[model samples]
Target: MKKNTIVTTDTIAAISTAQGEGAIGIVRLSGNKAYQIFREIFSPSKPIKKYQSHRLYQGSVMNGANTSSLDQVMIAFMKAGKTYTGEEMVEIYTHGGSNVINSVLQRVLKAGARLADRGEFTRRAFLNGKMDLLQAEAVLDLIRADTDAARVQAIKQISGVLSEFISSIKKKLVQVKTNIEVLIDFPEEEASPKQLFDLKFILQAAHDEVMHVLKSYDQAKIIREGVHVVLIGRPNAGKSSLFNAIVGENRAIVTPHPGTTRDYIEEAINYKGVKLVFTDTAGIRSSEEPIEKLGMEMTRSRVEKSDIVIIVTDPSAASRYDEELSIAKEHKDNVIIAINKVDIASKDQIEQAKNAFEDYSVFPVSAKTREGVESLVQGISGPSLAPSIENAPVINRYRHKQALEHIELSLNAAINLIDQQAFPEIVAEEVDSALAGLKELTGEVTSQDILDKIFAEFCIGK
Candidate 1:
């Protein structure tokens, strides 16, 4: 793979804080000329020949003409090799008005600092060996995390827990590859039974570890990216009422009329530290109206893409029981049957509804009264839908998961080759391939295009 070379010759500046009014905003600069640019634009309250590193000074940012002060600010100078990007850095803190922040940034730019690119600061940290690619991604995850579970996972990754694990796996693969190379070099020497057993044992251990990590990807994905749930049923089935009950707000319109919801209404909630996005789609029914037909089409598409499908039905809709059951059958793998309006339904009706959906997990709930709604919520947030793996590091990104899968495949090939007593050269090649995948996962070797794509997702000021 071709590695991208990083250059830190010019100073880069950007507004570090979020846009808009606040108590304070920061303008950050990093590179060889960071301090030089700072000196030109700032006039300290107390005149000093040399500035102290890592110390904040009261100063006023000078205007472009150097005729007057633009804003009163506190500036800090951090010497190279100890800052976030491992280069000389400067941060100017000013009053957080949009105009003031913009003026300060423009002054720094006029002093010979180029505007920083998206995630360029963090990318510099990665290239400077301050942190690995996994930690850099964790920084982004932590910034965007909306749930406590996601925040904890990002913290673990940023602390190097996942990097250490990947490194340990790579170390094992390298050792096994070294042993295989020795065998290949000395073809005249016959391999001992003990040596072959040891090789197979180590390879198997690595393969099993990869499998275990791969299993956590689903749970990690749910925590990082909120779950997608779609409520579906025939018209006048109380789907809208149940949606409001679950969201604890009147987000969806509810009327006695059928097909009230012509499109989907979505709302998100945090329950037990997991983000659940519930989409209330239009009711599914045979309709001659063009708009209703379009709404039904959108409902089918959402159901197909949802992580969980709640098939809502009530005793009042007993006549359409077959239609609801057919919909459930289509998504049997992730379908949950909810019997809504139990408060109004007679005991016999509730019992019959349960018996009809006996093959699946059924919850009898009164959306109007919120009776048994907690049980339904529990069922939706159950371990089957989102497993708890808090103690270990998880691979949340698709890139990481795909890389681990390739590593697993390569290790399996090596193990099979060993069992067949294949040539040492062939086994060594497989081991090398697996090691390369591990390297790619931690970014020891990666193409420039991949790096560009990963960093492009970040905001410009990041």
Candidate 2:
């Protein structure tokens, strides 16, 4: 369908609750004929001779022919222009149960209502001027938020903080573009030096705004998708012990024998309202055993995907994990050196371990005694826990990031043309391209395929 196409011609119905037992289940309908279709199957306790908007009545849902009741329900009606979809809507509140909800839904379908597609309700809201693309995307983010920090970012996006910021930038660009077009329309007029300077200034400001939003995608990604942390070290380096301590459980088996852990163990924990998924991989070693070799390969793959690598070191075998240390050093920003078993290590042994990895920040920790474990967790999530993040506009999706890049590119081209003293018409062309990028970001410029991919991410009945 086209971006502006209104989708309220046919009434749509769906079970708006989870597919299990609960306190209540809601069956929602929206379209021009919603009230008419709902009245066909719902019988009110007191006669509802006249249809009223925003009124609830006790009723029972009946079969298509209105002969037998299927379930007890309380039905509500909302007239057009004030509903979620900006069309007539009705909602049926029935007892929570799969059978009861399905039966009532079947009756509604049989009474000329079609089952709703995934995210059709919210899509309608966007098409009806209720919310923009940014807010619509936030609904899914809010639903899938795994931590308090992620929830805060999602709520800010949904509240139009990012949208309003982008709007302000776009409004300034529009004014600049209009003045340039006016100059182009009258070729006899030579643009003044002051006009050229002002144009350059506006373009630079827009470019800076786009770059500012782009800078936050990395931090937002960590909040939206939890950070992946992997514990890697040589055999019997206390990798398993540190993993268990961090997760607050004995999730991995502890053993004195080297190569006891032949596979990787994964667990997630919320640290300072941010999520950290820790994985305990097989200890890195020069083992020729087939199982140990295969486990090492998997460990390498996990390390490549992980956002943080905790290279645990045992003071007794200080020089044994040089190969693992080399690997961690390759990703300097993502590596955290942890000296485990510090409770038993002597002063010389601790000094030797720290000196071995002097290039990296090393933390002396004892997983068994829980010493310095909290500091390790904090070190793993560097800069993300800063309080300044609360006030920044976070771009949580790749879609938004790409749109900002487009705007930046367009503004750069326009600014270059202004510097070269190019024709006003050519400069206006670049401005128009930048304006289109903003429109696409806010759903003003979109296609059917784009709409389908975005809404498909949402759960049904949203």
Candidate 3:
């Protein structure tokens, strides 16, 4: 595998748009041969001597001679030093169809353009100094985001909001290191109390800021990867009904029989811009039947993985749901007591449900009528949902958290050394370690393995 793509002069091509039929599809190529390949295959309507940079030209993709026409396309030529890969680039917008785009890509490849690897386009951009590691990851995040909130976070990261924050902290750390070095150079000039106090303050501030960002990882992950919500209750407790109501579709079967739904079903719903992946599990019950017993086991497994468990209940006989309630109790922190089928129940039954799970936040909902379901959804997705995009540095990646952890530890060590009045040399070393971590965060120093792992998450077209 190539260590870096910066020095390579190979021209790479790929079908840069989604597969299947649409109004338009893009075949993209980058590197030295991009323009050469484009000119060779593309026959413009008007004869032109030289293709200008950043201009779109109407043309036909010719197979070999003028008589053999492939497809009508608009070819864009972007000059080197002003393109995405820091190399010459070409984009062919053809009629959107799998065969059409594939044919164009093959022609570009046959014209000496190599097939781009997964995320090779973005990878080249990163390697060529177009964007840093965090910004490059944002490109993938923006593509994968399922909700508006997640998209906003990704956009902020791409726009360098998070990078700027990290750079600020890094700058301060560098200044602290320089101060320590100055003290180390003159051992005769003992560091004053004021100078030591100043160093301590700076280190503490950086440590606190790191913690602030670290603490947001859970919330960010919930947004980036939608929250897993499981609807669990006893057999015939209306779990499927509630699931259908929330998903706004007839996804799971609804029946009078208790064990009709023997397996789990999942669907995603956007509640106030937050994506909630609600899974309707097999009704939890003590059944002697083999299939039903197997289903109960799956319910338990889903409960363990869920971020929120909505304990669906029949208000008419809420007391009969003790076993399901107990499961909710085990994960009580994330449990939502939803007393379902409220329309048929008496006032006494609703009161009984309230008393039974009074410790949990109980909501009376009628899935068939779609009452109180909206509020329930808001409650489940609200707390962790980011209030706005202005909170830009929401640390979505575990890699970013890991890098911050290393920097935190180094800052902590530096603080301890300063407190003990240890030699400034030792403190400077710890500070340098922290600086190295910052460099790693932004791709100033990255291994081929790391780059491959990050970019491999992208699809080939990216």
Candidate 4:
């Protein structure tokens, strides 16, 4: 990995838009010299001595030597303190052909502007206090979000919902710490019963809020990164057919012959704003053939890593019912039984199959006729598997979750000490530690290395 050299004072320029052919491409520059650089390269349709801030002007970009025009364009100049980076910024819009975009960027670079590093633009925005670290991370999340839920969550974070909530928690901790510190200074004064009760109440409330946010991490994980649902069962159990039915396309090869699927086939579908990646793996069964055995091994491996494992079976495979049920039991916590071929099976067979997996959630469906497939889809992301992620603020990043866990531990220690009527100094120390965790979470006391790693995940020019 290359190191990022971030010098906010220096004039930086880059192609902000993705590199490709499109209707328009943007070359962005930010710093003290942004306006000066723009003046050197841009020739407006009408001559003007001064450019108005936040106004787009039709123009033509000049070549590096300023002897010929490179491309017809539109330019916008934003004044410092009101721009995304809180610095004077300029954007040149040109035709999105590779040549035109590159030429425009090179011209800006030649005009005393250093090339912008990956995520340097947003990094500047963070350093300038236009947005907090959580919002900065959300910007990246928004760009990479593939589902509606992820996008909405990212938008909420970017709007400072999570930051404000954490800030409020920190404020409460600070108040408790201040009270303890005052008591420590005046050792002659005794804490009244009501005072002790109030302090404990605040601490307990803060702890509960932290735990609530922590519980949401699992659901946030599902929202930000979709769950992997793997299909597993013996050959001729209709695993491939079920896979095709759920994905609403013939993504996998379905045949009457056993072991038709030699490898896994995967397809993704967005259901209820959550992405579900379904993998139809080779049948799990005892086999002497080397290739079939390898495929079976892969199936078991997928089952272990999957977020949800669907065990496909049919009444015709009665002899292997126990064998398949045994495999499902290994991951019974996340396993869902899908009794396929129910369209032709007798009612007793379906009832018997359902009774066999009474311990797990079972859905009887015929892939050929598409019966009960929707119910099976709904079951994949049911409340037992994924928590409700409607509008509630959640900590999606591991960084935030780890900080919250540390804060919880500190709060727990403080609460215990307070209950025991320990020395004010010791209790204050624990509360202070929890406060530090909050600072770290909101980037009030973040390390340079951590900031680099966070922003490095962004693409160039973001």
TM-score per prediction, in order, is 0.92, 0.89, 0.91, 0.87
* Residue 353 in candidate 4, Cα distance off native in Å: 2.6
Total backbone clashes of model 3?
0
The deviation in Å at residue 148 for candidate 3 is 3.1
Off by over 4 Å in 2: 1-3, 64-67, 252-266, 282-301, 343-347, 386-392
Worst 10 residues of 3 by lDDT: 1-10
Task: Encode model 2's per-residue lDDT on 411-460: one tens digit a residue.
Answer: 99999999999999888888888888888887877888998999998887
Candidate 3 regions with alpha-carbon error over 4 angstroms: 1-5, 283-301, 317-321, 384-386
Clashes of 1: 0
lDDT (10s digit) by residue, model 4, range 212-286: 989988778778778889998878899999999999998899888988998898898888777888999997878
Model 4 has an lDDT value of 0.87
Clashing pairs in 4: none
Cα deviation at 251, candidate 3, in Å, is: 0.9
**Order of models, best lDDT first:** 1, 4, 3, 2
- Could you tell me which residue pairs clash in candidate 1? none
lDDT of each: 0.87, 0.86, 0.87, 0.87
Q: Would you give me the overall lDDT of model 3?
A: 0.87
